[model samples]
Target: MNPVKTIQRLWLLFLLQIPFALMAQHPVRLAVAGITHGHSDWIYNRKLRGDIEIAGIYETNADRVQEFRKRYQLPENLFYTNLEQLLDKVKPEGVMAFGPVNEHIAVVRACAPRKINVMVEKPLATTYKDAQEIADLAKRYGIKVLTDFETSWYASNQYVRNSYKEGRLGQLRKVMINDGHEGPWAMNRHFVSWLTDPVKNGGGALMDFGCYGANLMTWLMEGQRPLSVTAVTHQNRPDRYPKVEDEATIILQYPEAQCVIQASWSWSFSRKDMEVYGTKGYAIAADPVKIRTRMQGASSEVSQTLEPRSAPFNDPFAVFANVIRGTLKLEPDDVYELPVNVTVVEILDAARTSAKSGKTIYLKPRPALVQAGNVGNN
Candidate 1:
């Protein structure tokens, strides 16, 4: 055979094998910590795509365990009643949490001791104290901890973040985010008991929807601590959400800029979007996949579409894989880090407190009642 023909045939064979090579590479070993939260579907869909292996799963509630198992048609053998047993047996490299937001600390505490990484659904924890404890554990164990925001994966959100970071919008002036939907009851979510429990879900819409604004604001401000936060939460349907607030508004006051976060479960329609106004222009994450921009003096808005992010930054599994392999370095000031999450949790906590006390809670010391304070006192 001619040498050129021989070389071409070999190259063709290699090309044919590349697809299998890529498919088998970078598969992350993962486990599930809770399935009660509706967000479990996000990770489950990733599992279907073979991005991560569901090494094991545990839930305190047997019914929940079985319900999820049957719902997803997961293998019965994968369920473990005890968390420790699952960890000891499967020994996954990471854990994805889908339980109540308040359970984050306890689950992280368990996984950290084994040097296993963890990814929790947004808001980090129900309180700042829990956030701190999880931070300490992650530090001691030398494991990565990430708080997964549905918005974090949004290309439009990143577009806004990069726009401000690059000073494309000039000096930052204000951030206005409106995120939420019609009531969960209206949608008939199956596992909403915890989502409506003030202790478990952590302040209803202010927590469920408000955290998106807090997380994005923290990232945009470059982790600058706010002077104070003022907020108000209301329960429009007291009979339905007697224990929690269904609608809430939080304001974060910085040195030169302010952010208004409106989160609610009571709305005319569903919405999860944001608007960022700077000194010279403004950008809006009109939706998850679209961005609309307007210059200061422009007569019309310029709309652009954003392509979804690629692997490592695209999904939890890919990101977790890069994290365990030491390829992705999440800075302490990064929005996903514990310190940032702590502040986010603190802001939410203060929002609830402000609603109860009807005062602007200053972060410097305590909520010293002031006659003229006006941030969250409204």
Candidate 2:
């Protein structure tokens, strides 16, 4: 080849690489809706890291809008009075709905038709019908809908899931989990407003904190949908949480194992721990971020803890950004499929039904498990 021709071909190859490199570095633009939820702060801080831009913020309540603006030092132009105006102006690639549970459906409905990816705070919607509607809308539009079950993305949970896949826990038989904090009334004065309002919050502490237990249990058990769920609720602090139950104990039964999930807004003590018992070994963890395990024949327990590497928040905004950038695929949909946001809503609804009926409520039969070898095909 001629010397000049050889240099020209090399230049062409370098130019081709530039487009791919630039595309890899592009940021995802995200607009956040409803700044009243506590988790919104995490999203705000994480999005500031340069991978994502907080294009806009919307809140229905004027007071909340003012509070957020002052807290975050957001400019007036970036604040909108409602979701429709915000979406129209910003045209974000994704939206984080951090609104109240009752407002979730409306926000999702508004965004899904635009084919915007959305990450709704857990317990997708306040009611079963609304939850199903959101899921249906997203499916129709081919929008990726996810819940902010942040713990599911924790490194410790990933380690535990990997262990379960390796059969280290061996034929799981039972799980015991607790997720509680001081009652909402004591934790925040505003918590009692909509959270205790059955019309707005849907159920009670079960819908709020109980969903975490249900989601975590489902994730750890290889996505085994519960066959039946039975629950009991208590209103011990009726004066404080006037319209909502203060505590709840739930049992989720599967073909292979039974899970006990306890949630409360009345506990004076704070506890967040999980114990997994199986035919061969047992695993325990304070949160999904830390876990220890023991196998039947092992001489001693093996322990692992994931050091917090990022900010104090549990926001997975970077993960979402990577998904958009095509740098990382969504978590495998096998034993530990990334949860579809609506499924969390459905599980919470079932638990509430079981509690209300004073009897076990059976779920629709789950599809056959995607066996280990065939998991990736989906």
Q: Best candidate per TM-score, number? A: 2
Please, what is the whole-model Cα lDDT of each candidate in the order they appear? 0.80, 0.73
Tell me the tens digit of each residue's lDDT in model 2 across 261-302: 998887778777778888889888766577788989999988
TM-scores for candidates 1 onward, in order: 0.87, 0.89
Where model 2 places Cα greater than 4 Å from the true spot, the runs are: 186-192, 299-302, 307-314, 332-340, 366-378
Which 10 residues in a row give candidate 2 its minimum summed lDDT?
369-378
lDDT of 1 by residue, 117-188 (tens): 888998899987787677667766777778888787788988988888787788888999999888887442
In candidate 1, how many Å is residue 100 off? 1.0
Clashes of 1: 1
- Which residue pairs in candidate 1 collide? 230-376
